[model samples]
Target chain A: MSHPVACCYLKTGRALMSTQRPDARQLPSRRIADDLRQAIETGELLPGARLPSERELAGQYGTARNTAREAIRLLTDEGLVIPEHGRGVFVRRESPLIRLGNDRYSHKYRESGLSPFLLECAKQGKTGRFEVLSIDQAQPSAEVARHLRLPMSEPSVLVRENVFYADQDPVHRVTTYIPWTIAEGTGLLNPEVGHPYGIHGILEERGHTMTRLRESVSARMPKPEETRYLHLPPAVPVLDVLHLSIDQDHNPYELTRFVMRADLTGLLYDTPIE
Target chain B: MSHPVACCYLKTGRALMSTQRPDARQLPSRRIADDLRQAIETGELLPGARLPSERELAGQYGTARNTAREAIRLLTDEGLVIPEHGRGVFVRRESPLIRLGNDRYSHKYRESGLSPFLLECAKQGKTGRFEVLSIDQAQPSAEVARHLRLPMSEPSVLVRENVFYADQDPVHRVTTYIPWTIAEGTGLLNPEVGHPYGIHGILEERGHTMTRLRESVSARMPKPEETRYLHLPPAVPVLDVLHLSIDQDHNPYELTRFVMRADLTGLLYDTPIE
Candidate 1:
């Protein structure tokens, strides 16, 4: 039996075994895949090259043909190669696509003529509700002022906090900001109206229209308060999406910071039609 | 002070408390938002209904006006409410988009392209290589055989396993498979071909043209081997994407399973284009 690829495969196989000794009998395909996979990595077989026939492989490895097939199936799944029916398989070296802002609502839902939250809700076959935690008019904190683009001396700022739930599950926590100047008219400064239309409605009623949005995302370990509100098990990481919506005039009308469970919600992005 | 919406908000807030104490700092705006959010949930607000004015809501809750405004903003960020500049915030609801397979891949790669591994590498401007863990041909277990639609009595299967790394950091662990019959004539079956083209390349050459793919995703606590290979922290979870690709004849030629670190990869889905 010719052992051309076998030698290279064996060398790479040993390097892989150095980490942990797996249960050989339970997962033979894994062991076989690892052997040939290592050979490819070590450059024993050049890229865009062809592999030996299955009969040849079985003889060299002393394994059944099905096991060899499993090894090949694993590589094909990773976008590492292209398989042609009735022909043969070849190496694929195409670079994985690199996308930016694809997880953003601004990119995915902007065109649906619906808000990002609504889109997310209906997709899950669930509904969303906002349970405002606190609403207060106070001197803008330095951080709040920076985010809302309010002056340090801004005498009044509106802070609205809420926990968002889907199917009775707490899915999001957010705090939004609005500077006093933009919020002062039309009796919006009064808290007496209970919870009225969201800021978009109020701003629109006041003649300001939102035209653009910006967001920054980061991941961090969840805090206790977050765990309690989100019903998260300890140590579940959170995806923080902090976004600001600017009106047509390029003025910041709303600054929102959101904390969400990383696993439950999947983000989607759509490229702007060219 | 009237409390038209207070009762509704309090009832739900109490349910969410998990514990019994009611915190006093919570204001009417919160109650209103909560109440309105609940209304939305119970279908009381309907998807397109207009909410009361800030003054109207403030009067309804007997709170100051700013409180009412803040509550609305909270709903906006959660994607429950759509705030049009001039059009008061209305119930923003829409169905989920039907995503195409190609779109899904494009989005996932774009959002986290070359994330941590690439980030570190690019910052230093260095290139890395794939390390083979093991490669061999093995018999397919019942499960592998079922997925491949192959009979158990057929020749042995081909299985390949590998771990991808960047500077020794385990990025992903994969198990690949290919059937013996198709691979028998192809050089891929031979051990001497060793580093032959990636499996995809091998199949393409063998006349198996792959045009469609199916991916099933699940999340779980990482296993010991997964933890060690990916070097994942205890708190982080693992996401497994099982890929099955069939040739033009509708026969699955490859089945590859990939385990990725949740912290390192953020999966993105794209809304199908109409």
Candidate 2:
């Protein structure tokens, strides 16, 4: 259930070398990358293991040090390695991936008063922390307005923006927009909200029980602000997951927008069919 | 229902500018990009609308033409704009987003012999097409091995690889691996298996009905092979959706790996809560 990232990475092992030789024009760095990549896939080079220095790689392969460095760069772009300025290159650690399922939003978790992030982190044997970047009364974006079924000019939202971190690594930055009507007279407008249960519990307690959730998932290059805050490498994209929470009557309530680091995360969803 | 991509893009309207003034040190291009992004978000610059030429932008902003070009480049990188070689830059159009829920695999769809992809595309009002890339019995990848619960030592799979297109645009490339045991007794080995319904229909008719599906989603830069086959621009990310199909008895049967264009596709999953 955990380590989804590792499982996905292992899928690349499908690239088995064929008996046929490579094209004569293939770059040396590309060939080097393929062999190193194969080693990583087969577990010959485990995560957290350091690769040989450029000089060593060049000496062994009889190629330019820059060419060896380029091979390492290729692996880094593939999310298989990370280069620390002066410390050399090391295999990237595959974090315990995010496994989001139907159960996380259960009344059980709500009753026990634990934020989903906190519960998920604890379940994965990691400490979770969230910082409230800001909380304010603001104009709802057009999508939020649509979800809340309000004309854009007339609606406002209680925007609670926060970033969730597992230990020291910032994993996701979320902005949850709650309509003024649904948020009014509830603790949701407060920056602190419902301590243990979070806003969902508060919403449920207020008679607006969530009956359904709609989520749309996409990925894109991160914005400059996100690049700085998320510490994402140049090549890794960001996952944009938007969630819409609806009450028992299917009335929409909160819309949370998540900008997550793609390299460090994988979303797991399961559904039963007839 | 048809274009999930367009709906997701409409979501960018979530950014409502703040009243506070920004600090003066922001880069000129960054500032230019933000304002243009806001215009796009608010619908002032609609999709497919051509952006001002670099010369016009520079003249209007009293900045270098190169600075203006950089700003447009920023938008293109964000997927907000597309630059067609000599045609200049224009707002990117939204394609039909893939809103895949649990229903596409229901008994009704299977009985009606509707392939999930066709049903999905039709519901969105988009024409769908599939091109078979290759069909062969081959060694299953480790992920497939794990999904089918077979030892790495033995077991092969009937691999069916295909590319899907929406209208004229290549949207997704899918490779499905079925264990030899499950595939041997069915028509799934054929390049064209249970047409109109695909493999699931044949499996259902054979009483190996799929009862559940588990999906994992991740994103990264596309491989050179994928870039060439999928016709993906260098900046766009690819969504890697790996799915496992399980029968009523909870035994895994099929493993399908999809490499979809992230910019043109979004997966919509909805579920009910107690």
Candidate 3:
């Protein structure tokens, strides 16, 4: 639990004095990492640029090889660099960011024969497609049931899971849950739900037009399953978005969760002050 | 760059067979970390629960002490656990999550005698306050200039930097940029702008009543300064929000950037579809 650098500071009686000036008290490795991070942030080092080898860094910083290695490890853990076997470490090259705005769900775009994700990709000159992972009936979890306003006695809800890809790279793992009364004996169960309007269109035709939406957004390190599915890089987190669709009568009809790679996604919200 | 365990698998000729099943091919430390992560996620190990000591874990798993340490390090890096000085490692106990929804900006709440951050904190029974870091005139960064439609000839904008606290813990570091044309002689440049409406009210009186807003949200690791300001734990990312305010005449007036701790904030957006 003790850091050698901290011990050195304490022995010198500098730790107490450095409390008023924290930057003066930082470990050598951390200072080196901070300088490299600033270089990356300011575009002094471009993406795919190779960083100096550990030995070179050690020579430049007048530190031990282990100290240099720790600096590089810090950048790797920040998702700013990737080290290749037998090759040098290079700055990470990020995919084009996809911005999801509230207008993506506007009904006006529904007639364009494209789902929201596809439409967004088209606008950005990126190809988008989704693979239907599963469509089945399952008992809704407590959260899902509450969001959909289904009673505990309800038998089951329809679950449709899909992995969406942008430019052939997996970006989102979406799982949608629909009430049994609304999804039973419909095209909702099919893997191929015709596009343009997609599932929302089908729901609208069934007297449940989505008039509103509620989205809760948070971020965290990706789970192992998410890391595997999204092919996430080291230290990359995922944006967890929980979405709810409500009808004109205030009925919450559907609940969907989107797990998106944080490195390649941004969320935008534009609304009135009222 | 070579993993000893992977080398062992290759030596035993099990590498190829295990490729089809990733879970079966995981390194022992990773498997152990995943098991602990699931226990945390499923609430089996509640927040503040102490994990088994490293020696106990090593004995139980029949592994080396270093392997047990690595497993614990993985959990620590994921922000799931914290190692205390002299005490055993314990699960991280998060503060109550503050949900920031669009309604927080509704004009009706402007009369509540509290800023949005303070209002939200009050609702959650937490005290919120802010300390003005600085107020000065600075040339707008390119991005800020573009957002405010300030021509290159424009000299500078009023910059107000503040750090907001929730229950005495710094949660947001906000930097607001206002066009000099609107803030030249206004109270916006003053550290104390009074309560309730605050700077916004002064802008409204100057015929810049904000009617619309656009927020761009992304997540990434905290910078060194942010890590210090927010007192963030290791491996915890932060939410970066860029906010632009527009008046009824569609004039973009204010630009503010909010750097918030991901562990303590959740952004909610509830809006009607067009």
Best by DockQ: 3
- Candidate 3 reaches a DockQ of 0.65
- DockQ head-to-head 1 vs 3, winner: 3
- For all predicted structures, in order, the TM-scores are 0.39, 0.75, 0.87
**Cα miss at A116, model 1 (Å)?**
5.9
Q: What C-alpha lDDT do the candidate models reach, one value each?
A: 0.58, 0.75, 0.81
TM-score of the first chain of model 2? 0.81
- The TM-scores of chain A alone, one per candidate, are 0.54, 0.81, 0.84
Better of 1 and 2 by lDDT: 2
The clash numbers for all candidates, in the given order, read 119, 6, 2
Best by TM-score: 3
Q: Which stretch of 10 consecutive residues in model 2 chain B shows the poorest summed lDDT? A: B1-10
Per-residue lDDT tens digits for candidate 2, residues A35-123, read 77878878988899888887777666656677778898778766778888778888887766765565667777766666666777888
Q: What is the TM-score ranking, best to worst? A: 3, 2, 1
Better of 2 and 3 by TM-score: 3
Candidate 1 per-residue C-alpha lDDT over B1-43 given as tens digits, one digit per residue, 9 for 90 to 100: 2356443334334433344355543555566777777888789
TM-scores of chain B, in order: 0.52, 0.80, 0.86
Q: Which candidate is the best by lDDT?
A: 3
Model 2 per-residue lDDT tens digits across residues B1-274: 0111111112443323344365442555666777788888889989988777877776666566777788887787666788877788888886657655656667777556666777778888888888888888998767689888976666888888888887787889998887887778677767766433467877767667787788889988887678878998646899999988888889888888889998778787777774
Supply candidate 1's per-residue lDDT for B177. Answer: 77
True contacts kept of 2: 0.86
State the TM-score for model 1.
0.39
